[model samples]
Target: MGIPQVSETVERLWNGWELRMVMLLSLYLQIFLILFGRRRKYTAGFWIGKLVWLAYLSADWVATFSLGILAQKIGDSNRGSIPAFWAPVLLVHLGGPDTITAYSMEDNELWLRHQLVLVSQVVVAFYAFTRSWWGKDPLLFVAIPIFVAGIIKYGERNWVLRSASSEQYRNSVYSEMNELDSKFDKFSNSEFFEMTDERLVREVDLNGIITEATFLHEADLFFQMYRVLYADLVLGDSIHLATHIILRKKSAMQAFELIEVEMGFMYDVLYTKLAKVRKSRVIFRASIFLCFVSALLAFSLGISKNNHAYSTAEITISYLLLYGAIVIEIYSVVLLLFSDWAMLWLTGKRKPLFDSVYRTICSSGFLSFLQHDKRWESTMAQHNLISFQRSKAKLTSISLKKLLGKSNIQSSKVVGADLKKFIFQHLLDKRTRYNLRMRSHDPGSNDLHEILSERGDEVFGREESLENFVWSVKFPDFNESLLAWHIATDICYHDDVRINGGNAKIIHQNTETSIELSNYMVYLLVDYPFLLPRGIGKERYSQTCSAVDDHAELLDRIISVQPFSWYESAITFDIEKSTRKVSALWAGVKLAKSLQALGTQDGWGNERKWKIISEVWVEMLTYAASHCGWKEHAQTLTRGGELLSHVCLLMAHLGLSEQCLTTSRLD
Candidate 1:
């Protein structure tokens, strides 16, 4: 059997006219997406553009059959032209350049690989173009605008990156100005501001500065109590909010983990609600069916003879390609429709559910409930045990003479003014400066040995009191473990320590309280604010006040902890890391707020802007506390909301200026 031949004329028409038109259209679509798509709406543009490009690249196969048929009519004997000129060109396009790729992040990586690919593709494309001298020069014309558009898109992205740095700098300076105004405004309205007696929210002078050291110290002071407020949240209480925030922050893996945790907890909460489960199943099934039907129709049309299919081999391949696409679309649509968002809404009005769950977590009256996982429990226990031992030591002091068995020298007399002697004589072999600070006096060799003995016993569970203790020390381990414990500290203790005017106690109390209060306030604003008191006689009002006080104390403590010797450590906590931790807590709260808005009478149409504004307010609050530092506490308000507000003001001014510029340009 002789192979069918494709005439040169038919082959030229297939490549020059049909293929060029499709490629040109795809390029235009990509350009449209780059200009109009919102930052958050990239998913829509990405998939659509991807599919269009795929189709354009695959269209050659579709043209092959028609060209072969035309050639056959012309009585050509040799097999049809392979369209080999396009094959290499298409390969070059697939490789992409340094400026563009399949992903946005890839553009930012070291460009050696991209440059190599770029050079190779350029060479390959030129070779293909030289070979592809068809009767019409359709590709050259089509490529021109496509090339221009690609350059513009690449340049625009680069401009955004370069411009954002300056924007942030200008934003910072403007923020500072706005912060001064806010402080003045706050000070002026001090009378209008309600005062609280709780240790956490006790009004304190900020001393007119915001330094990094102070910021971290203050954050440390209150984050503990905030962690407790969302014990349920931290331990996986509100799955919908937690899951949404995780996904929003682009932490899909963590979001899935949170979902698993939520599902397990929900199974316990909704154990009796068989009807809800049945409803979910029905929705899931229906969505799946619809997706399947759409995909099957699309696939069937693609495989039909009117669409493509030339030789028996080509027909088989085309059917397979169509089948794969159909499968992909069906799965995607099914997943989207029955997603976490849909299932959550279908779970019925869950505002009350969220509230009930939150309250149960918060007011269980069991402090133990606040700790998550065994590691946290161990850390807390270490904190408590140390405090308890320190209290016992203060209460029961042994004289040096008694310890020396009636020796003439007193321990205090021998130690003199040096506390190191006191510590080493009684407790451990060596002592840290922090240990001396904890004692409120220097520790000598005897004192050190005694302290170490007590510490070891507490740590190793040598005594019953030590074994039964809830926390081991005032502070636990120094690294990730201790910090995590501080985040879950109790509010009452913080209040007491603040009243006592003790630094060690205040430090512990304040850091935990502040972080907790911030987290609590966000949650209240977002999900459980109804539990908060409106004006007076609200049951949770006192609790809310306490949380706020703790937060204020946290802020104060952070200011006090400033001027750390190593400022580099402070700068290491860049925006991304700070925001990651902030976002994790914010996610649950954001979900709650969104849900609360939805459940209201008007369905949230008018309130969307305000809701967004509130979130901005919270973001500002945290960012100020975390980023602006103790010395720059005054600047905290500026970097966030005040700064953003200032930018809006600038844009307004800039817009007027722009209009004037345009008038001048026209004139």
Candidate 2:
């Protein structure tokens, strides 16, 4: 074929199917998002988040563009009736899925921008409907209910966005707690309601009811109380007292499980519509469902009369659209029926049919995978500063590890049972000592919050043998302190690896826990500094890495740092130009030498050495948790929840935070 003929044929085909193709694409994106969007919270790999994000953005653009096309078709009076009906369908797509709304906390803040888009699209859709053969066509009446359903769904999207906005979320704290209070009243009459604050302190077994159901109830309750902490508000006495006592009786794993459920609920609120219009969600869902079915049936009947006017492909595509809409409706209903909100709603309701169906579905293996116990991937991201810098120094255009982000120094470890037990036991032991002091001297919680705020000085104060090593802990700033300890920890860990040579399994495993925490903390500094208290951590990290990234001997065996300076660019942190006689990395080396000297002193061995380091690392973890703004913690929940956030919540449950009603800021 000649070029002009080929172009004409391509143009003709596109004109015939442009609207149809976009409609199908819009539906496909809707399906893609609803099924996989929630996976961001549980699934591993960077690609899933990126794919969901792409689909999330595409779904809106395609739907909006379709609305514009429909308006133009109506104004031209070409396929006006069918195009008018489709405008509402585009609105349904614009509403998006129940699985996600805002991809990040930043997306939630742009809710006003979404509001503007919603207004403009609604206007265009309305214009399309009016410009269509309204009076002459019976299709107008059939389109009305569909438009109502579409508007409700789209409006609900904006409502959730607005509700999740930072300004509104902070205001939602008390209202959530108030709702929780009502649920507590319902539970007050049952055996399931046994874990009152005072009761939890004395109870041996942790409360009553079936396992999963009990967790949902507790999740609802805790999210209500601790969401105040999430909003950075002061907790009332009643909220903290109950949480402290309940956490005291439970094992570390149970405490973490409770927090996971709490985070899961928070995720639902910020990223889904379940937490919005809770009292009326059922009514709204039913209304939209009925309207949709009505429109489908109306179209099915009305289309037969106009079958002669439309082409076979157009007819086929229209049915495909209808089927896709039905599938989406059914899928959303399934999600709703099995959702945490559904579980919460079913908690005290003894309606036999709903109750039996709910339990059977939850217990069935066929659908059981949908009901997971944990809400996140449960892996702590690990990055060794010395090792990562070494690899980064050698990075080149053809480096496979850089291309794939497959650096061994940067990875994640599944937070195992041993680690959980150690962490819980450590806190349990701390609380026990505090209780002992209360019994003998009554030091009050004022000192406890002060200690909670310490990065490592608190650990130093409690151990006289660690006094000489206090310089590493009590640095001039938190960022430099983190860098110094990170390097020192890496050195001691590697030296032990060389010395131990696969000895006792138990002792080696203990060493692994401390190394993991050390690596994980440094990982946070490099990748997720927002989760920590405000610091020049990234700057110090860059300075440290830039200093030693190319040092062959140090890395073969590798490290540096400085304070944040507005006047000085990070690139200017050249090692030779530093004001200090001893550079940051060299200071860490000196500290490591000091620790190595003490490793065998006073009958101390590698075992005791790592134990002190392990304990101090935990203190640093808690310090980061307590000092970080709650808003930062909440923001991490949508991305599978952070270990820091979990520890932070655990500390609050144990009454370790300044936000705890029993603790006063001594400062």
Candidate 3:
């Protein structure tokens, strides 16, 4: 009746419960690494490699647990041992196959080492099965599911390596639109501009005055105005839509397509003048491949067997793979939702580029007539024509509080004092203000307005005809300088402050907007002097904003050749249409500035500092462009330069010493 003594090895493992303790420890480690290790910030690939190997080592404990479970049920020691060894065998098969366990692209290099560990585990599992005094059992059927899942995971990892590593995918699509066959070459007549003409209105940024000016030139004012309003409306929609797409649940393919579309639009915008698009396709393919592999792995796991035990290893592995699939799918879904429909919508809002040919319009500009309050009211009325005419208009107006949410500040006040102050402080110079007031400020000007209204009545006659004429009327004498000033204030005060304050936290949000247009144009024209504008028709303009990114450089070069210098006097005159040309020129200049800074500074300091400085400038410029009425001036230059100084100091502390010492002039 004496109990059979356990073997010496089993006895040793039982000393303070070493075997169970090791298994438990292994289980904890695996769970911890899988859940949290991947998210550890700034961890090198080496640690990630170690974690992957840890999962392999831990799988042995899972095998031992399986064996123990089998042993308890079978009663016979020989039958029990077979199931025990099977766990390790399955673990060996499943262990070395993941692209994201380390969450770094470089982690793929460890796959070779994974092969080595995998081989060793296979050997151990084989020995455990054969050398041990264990009998076979039907429960060993569990290994079948595990083996299939392992194969799937391995294949997924391989797919990720192939797709993500491809160089062709990194280029964007917006850069290719300019290459479309130049079918409308007839519109190229207005493309050439004599840059040296002093009479031509120029969009200039002189110190603080930059923020005050919106119209680069009076002749170009309508184009800028059109660009702003169109971009505002369309980009707003895109932002709303992109946010929806990213946050919503969707299939991997759907999400991939959406994100791809966004990238394509960016390419078009950046590369309108170029013949070829660059690397976006490659990156897109890589992204799609990753999601595809993830989907396959999830499919394999979903069909796998369910386990009853809470602590069972099968349940754990199944859950891991299932959740991983969800993450991948969801990530892709979010990406797709954020496509560049917003950018396209905004860019084309000014006017359909195709229709522009018939309309004889190539670009948009500020409307000087809009400076008159009555004229702006007319424009607003025109904008609301459909809404105002709708049967639900009165009801909607009454419920505006509900639809738009409660107004924080009274609408009138928000646009009154703050707006007037902004306009006077930034937009009006003493000379222009004096002249404008003297010519237009008479109280009796309203009588002149009455007289003009009466005179117009004599000409057009009927009330219906007058209303129709009013609706179809275009603004006269567009003021590019004043509008640019408003835009500058808008960017600096409204958008920048809100964004930095975390009220408007959006990723890839900065890339789509009228503000983005202003910053991009300014950077192109002012920063890159040697480049010239190549005449791209309206269709090309639309395409450029929507094309792939690889053509960005080509677009930059083509636009740079146009004369790009900012002169204050240019805004006062009936200058030739050239804001698009200048904007393109500045974009190159801005990019070149970053390059120059990056080139001279050696070590990481140069690259890092220059990049930070460039980003700071961009942020400032974008902010200024969004909120203020400034049309043509690059107003963010002064504030951005000031911020750059502070950023340089900060970078020095973070190992950017040389950049802080470098004394480059903003002027």
Candidate 4:
């Protein structure tokens, strides 16, 4: 008898609290998304991303579930008026945060499905509102403005999602290019801006003064011209011709800054509600915020007169939902004002006052979070080959770790200043010059890609001193080649450490650049293999790591004490996993010997040898950058992006793309 009574009482409370619980959960989800969704653009971590991902997926379900519960309670006279008023509050949560419209690029492709669900949900929302207290209740009348705001919010999400889809995005790009062609009837009509030879980019009409606003406009221009690259489309050779003519004149610093701005635009296009820059966005912002304010005012007044009739819990929840929503909506509108989209549109208008104030705030750096992110953390994750082995060499298979995407890495470093300049200048001079000559003369995408994707071998052919080391690139699969080079680079780097007479001594700049690029490549292979050319990289990597693990003590001794040759006792070349284990270590040792021999062969110093090694690594990096598919590049933008994606976009602008160097998207 006691158990039965307890069960009955528990069921009663659950039935009463189910709708309220779901309502609060849906609001909490909206709060979570508004606060944290933007972090995925700039933060790099597993747990933060997972939390936001969970919240993004759950926000919609809870809102829809709340509506279903309300639709079921339409005739319960005491609760009906409260549920009816709360129904539209659920719709505002369904609108989601302005910071996130789609979680991934693939989510944008499913806009039609979202639209169908939107229609069904709107039908249910209306049914629940109209069935209860229609003409009799003042609460139902106050819900009218909230209902309108909810529809606009939900519909705006679907619109942005649709605009970001591939077919819609590509069509818009083509239409804008046609408009550009119409505007440019003659070269003489175009006005020169940024007259400095090192930073010049073509603009239509402006005084020669370059403000912070000018960078936003410049980013808008570059994004318009090159945005098609993100979607894997081809551009006409003329767009290629026009871009390279300007890019070639830029210094490495100016060049990277320009690319950073363009990438910021790409991030907005993929992740946020700003799918395209337009004046219509301003109007939408005004409409949504005004609707929210009007609803809050009407609801507060209506509820006060009927305050005695509703339950205390019902009144409290209604106030929380209203006040919380208006606060969030106000912040969203302020974010829109400070967004790159708003700044871009505002900058384009030459109307005097807005442009000056906008530029002043941009340069002032008052709200640093709102500033267009100039660099994303400026750090690269570091996962060295031997270090990975030393850390993760238990008996379990690596296949599971790969499947779950658990990285063996826990270390990262700021991308060194000189390393960035070194890579920028190398691609600026070598890859661009070579790719342009080939593509302009012959335009076969596949054949051109195959030829240009020579990872390190081409560098050998170009440099006379490194001809003897060409076989290392030629003798293995690309993955094997990476392992071989990584092994050799590590050995040579340690040898330099010893040669400096102390491990703490600052080495040559070229040696530091070589090791940084080398370790970064291994990080990509281990953690983000899809960004690399299709390869046996992970398999080869695991085997090489095992090799280092087996002989860690001996290897350490060789580095700190004796010459490498004294460790011959440790070698047993089991040929089955030739690219891994002992055989792989031998390959590295042999290559290291060859590099050292080359350093001593003539009048060349350590600087000459390190320069060759660093140049080869840069070539390998660019080769991987170009050959990675554009879709992979687009997907990485959500995870704070990758250095390889940054390089790939810059490569396209300089005519070194794996594609035919033809794409244009301007809106």
Candidate 5:
């Protein structure tokens, strides 16, 4: 059969309209990417994440498909007469979006595939350029340098991907350890000054002037502590001292700012080229700018000379390409300048002009918006399984109203508790006591749970039986313990008013923390099973669900008498006696009653009672956070992140995880 041919009308349309449409489409995709690329970090909504994911994948595909079409056009005699200038423009588009390099950690590991794509695309772009070359056209001169810049930018994305791969990142950390070890050896024998009990009672004096210098100093100190994250190193006593010094010196807001900057650096290292190009950022920036300028100048000269036969549409498209490249470059430069990386670099220089500029930018509302905490991490999405189940049970009008989207909601409710500050304060207090006790006597091979329990005992005046009951250090199954505690917390929370009617303020605060932490732990249990301890969270969840279902008739009666009173009635039915099997809810109710009875029998004050409960909750939270794998934590970053993951990292940095033991062994 003879090869098929298109009609002249179709050919003309393809040449004149379709090609420009694709180019315009590619440009629009780039614009979308620039605007929405960082939205995933700030949002945990299903649609927003899906949209960003779509844009992320589609941007590369559209650019590549358009380049293929351009290549096909280069071979057609009729379309061959059309300006091939768009070929290099497509190359620039194919360099991919700047706002994201890798969507997730797994993407970083696929750098080899991207490298192959880079080679193939460069060859295809070059083929299109050469086939359409008509001997020294001024427009071709403009395209050449812009193409080089595009290649460099694209190559940079892949280089960053390789550098950030876990293996490569660990290697980079290991590379620095020889110097670290030498310094460590030199300091190992130096006797450290121990603070006396009297000196410890007096808070560390922090009267230094709070300025950019002070903030930078604290950031540098924290960054040193954070570097252990990359190296898989234990946060030793040096890290503990650094954290204490910084926390003592800085206010909570200032301390959180340093943390934000540290997280920003981490985000860049994992998902951007910040670490890969830090040293040569200025040089790379200048090179890209100069290339764009050269392209702009060459294109302008070509327009002035009118050396080639080009349609007005083609000429306009060329102009858009040149201007778009320059404008995007300028935008990227602005982002780089206002970034935490730039701030860190400027702080290191200690120049007055740089400091003034930094201060001015920091004071601006726009810069604040750019560097806002939300940009780095979203407020964690709360997902309590029991709450979720209650909502699903359709038991209450309020939950039904929320389900039907009729709660007069105007914005996403800040439903989750701000536990970061609380966790930090608790760790700080615990570490102080831990250091004191460690100095006084040997801790031996005691794990994190033991240490926390020992320190907790000291704080609460040694309630041995109570401590053992609340947090059994030798408990073999974490999942079961979590279920028991979670249920107990929920029961106690609902029964708070009945238990402590007079002290509203203390009861309310403790109840809030207990409920929030309880829900968060259950969220991990049901939604993120891998992050929980070694048992099957799903199987346990299924068993609980089956038990709840089996008691449907009884639950209906309870709900009829008092809706949302499942916990109240659940306490009466002993799980051990029930035919359906031991229910988590029943176990929880027993625990709650026992705890309340203990409080009454011991004549414990409201403060002491709540303190004990909160301490136990913190211990459970720490246990889960410390036990969850780092890979599991990293996996959550692309999904607007999770509080569990943040807590995990925080626990590791605080030297409260068994991973720290592994790291110590490495040393």
Candidate 6:
């Protein structure tokens, strides 16, 4: 028998090999999209972000290209070809990944463009199906339902993008408030005011002990408060209540977890179909499930009926496409089940069945892996320009290590678990004290700065005169103060080690936190200067660098003479005079000396002295964070977010932000 071959027309119009390659490429892109879309939320390293960025851009392009190829093949071929059978699968791919609908906030604004693409692609897909199937191709039964499901999925994505856009979010919030107001006016003014105030007061029990359950309930109740963040609305009594009911009561770890869940909800509201899915969750899930099942059944029936008509390669590709769609749908279902949305649902339920399921899931190890709260597991990254300048050789070595894909060289410098707990506890204590003071006085009686200063004095057991010396008069310029305090902390930290001598190990824990935070703040100063208070000139930074460089020779000599000696050992070479003549380092050295002297004079233990310094730095950090513009904090969400931004949001919620003062004025 003569060798069987494809006809000349078929070979010229559409090659089987080319169609297969495109189909395989589309599948590979889908796999990449699904795997890496959510990785950014957990891993904020450079390489991971780059890979996710690449995958994000390519997923849509590859899917669109495959759809184009399928359309072309169907139009060109004399008879219906296998590639035509795959057009609906392309539609499914075009729906995009569930993990990310909009890559950034701006992407949400392009929903109309996505909608246009949706319409055009659906037309092209339908045209391809008509050209190939006419009335004969049984796979059309499968294609029709899958096509519908794909359109629905794509529409859901567009809807989410639109809803998440800033304008839309603000409008939604305004509409909700207006509706509430309209309902209120239906009652007498006195009655309405009494009922509303009662509702607000009854929502949270201020005197009651706060547990995880209570915190969760408060989070749900304060949805309106959080929603205002997106709309840039001024918070009122709701935020003050939140502080008393939630923020002040929880331990640091619990507070952080609450914030994590809150951020997770924000992420969902801004980036995914979560808001839409949440409205008709059960119905939506059932509808999608039915579509998948119907598509599978239709595909199975079509294949069984026409098994002999299609080539083995074509049949295998068909099966792969069907199964791939099924797998993606299943994965999305799992994500929905494990998300904070599920937790929210569980929190709202009164049913025994849901409560038991929630308890079981919360206790399971699997929940840890599924939880999408952490942006990065490490506390925060550290990058100090001054430290880098001090050690060029070490910088070169770190660069090499990074190039070789080694872990962070400063990973050891990450805040230890014990230190984190201490910082949290100290901050919580300060907040509690501040809250008490506020309650004891009249509302709006003291400004934020006055309150902070009073709290600082109380915490350090210092009178106003001593507080003025350490913080007020000596550190008038924010940047200069930061530089001086940072250097002072470094000096004291090294000096404390030498002073402890035989007991260095015992005192190391106390000094380590001070050193870490000092460096972290300086790192922020250099890398993210915009976050700090303004009005400090660049000359101040230059002067400090000059002072450090001027003392380099003495520093080297001190290091050589006493390899393990304290940094203060170099001060004997008129270092104090040079620092004073050159820049603010003089103030730093004096401050360090004063702190040490006070600790000795007051018989404050090594732990007690370091605790005071740590608390002071934490206060400074929180002040700076709270002072930064909300728009600046919002901008960080696209770059994998930051702890500072989270802190700012927390501060705003607790009615501690200066931004809140301005916002309140607007009201």
Candidate 3 minimal-lDDT segment of 10 residues: 374-383
lDDT of 2 by residue, 1-667 (tens): 9999999999988876888898889989999998888887665456677789899989999999888887777535355335356788888889888888888878889888988988898888888888766535545666687788888888989988998887898887777656544443332222223445546423322243344576666666677777777776765434554555667767778888888878888888888765623657878788888887887788778777766545577567767776787778788877777777777676546466656766887778856677664387778888887777666556656555446644443778989988988888877766654431233223352466556756767677877887777778777567677777777788776665555562334355667887788888887877678877676777777777765653445345322221222123333333335454333575666677677667879888887777777887887887788788877887777667778888888777666677754422111
lDDT of 3 by residue, 1-667 (tens): 2344456656655642443444444445544544433222211123443564566456545544544443343324422222332334234223322212323434433555555645554454444544333444323433444434443444444433333321311221112211211221212212212122221222111112121121121112222112222222111111121122221233323322232232222222221111112254334435544544554454344434323222244344434443543344344333322222222222333445533431332122222221122101100000111111222324535554444432211111011232222222221121122121123333343232222122112222332322422211122211121123222322232333343453333422222222332333333322321121222223333222332132334333222333333232432121223334322222223333333333345453333433332233333332222323211111111111111121211111111121111111111
| Candidate 2: residue 438 lDDT (0-100) | 35
* Predicted candidate 4 versus true structure: per-residue lDDT over 324-413, tens digit per residue: 888888778777777777776666666778768676767666557565553476667777776566556553766644666766555776
Go through the candidates in order and give the clash count of each. Answer: 87, 3, 121, 5, 0, 0
TM-score of each: 0.22, 0.87, 0.26, 0.88, 0.82, 0.79
Q: How far is candidate 5 from the true structure (C-alpha RMSD, Å)?
A: 6.1
> What's model 1's overall lDDT?
0.28
lDDT tens string, model 1, 1-667?
A: 2333456667677644454443333333333332222111112122443543454334323333332332222111133222222322233223222112222222223234434544454444444444334422222232232223223323333333332232332343354334323432332112212223231122322222122122222222122212221121111111111111112332223222232222222211111111123454455335533433443454355446333323454334333423432343344333333333233333233355543443453345442332222010100001221122224335466765446433211111111122222211211112231122133222243242233123222332442432322232221221111122222223223323443464544333223333333333333222222222222212222333333233333323322333322123332233113323212211222222332333243533323422322222232222222222211211111111122111111111111111111111100
lDDT of 5 by residue, 1-667 (tens): 2334457667668757887787888887777766666565545666566677887788788889888887777645665344556777777776665667888889999999999999999898888788677433335666677777878888888888988887787777664544434333322211222443333223222123136555554555455555555456654443444345446544444555565555555666777654423657677777877987887787777777874556678778777777887887787777777776677666656667777887888889999877665444535334554445554566444555455443322222242334556666766665555442234223454445565333123434466557546443233566666676776665555555443542435464556676666666776676577877787566766676666565546434432323344345453654445664434655655666676666666567545666677766776776676666666666666666666666555544455555442222211
| lDDT at residue 544 of model 3 (Cα atoms) | 22
For candidate 1, the C-alpha RMSD (Å) to the true structure equals 27.3
**Candidate 3 wrongly placed segments (more than 4 Å):** 1-11, 14-30, 37-99, 109-134, 166-667
Model 6 CA deviation exceeding 4 Å by range: 1-19, 42-46, 78-80, 133-138, 175-214, 275-279, 363-369, 372-378, 394-409, 412-446, 449-461, 464-480, 500-508, 526-608, 631-641, 658-667
What lDDT is obtained when candidate 6 is compared to the true structure?
Answer: 0.63
Q: Output the lDDT of residue 379, model 5.
A: 51
- Pick by lDDT: 5 or 6, better one: 6
* lDDT order of candidates, top first: 4, 2, 6, 5, 3, 1
Q: List, residue by residue over 1-667, the lDDT tens digit for candidate 6.
A: 3334556656655565677777877877777767667766655566766677787788788778878877776644453446355887788787776787877778888988988999998898888888667535546666777777778788878888888777888888886544433432343322322444335435443223223345555554444456665577654433443344456556666666566556656666776655423656666556766787788777777778877656788778877877887787787777788666676566456556776787788788888777644444445556443454466444434454466543322432544467557756655655554442234234465455564443234544555435545452235567777777777776666566555563446565657776777677666665567777774535676677777677666544332323443345557446666743436666776676677666665556667778777777777777677667755665455455666666665665565654343212211
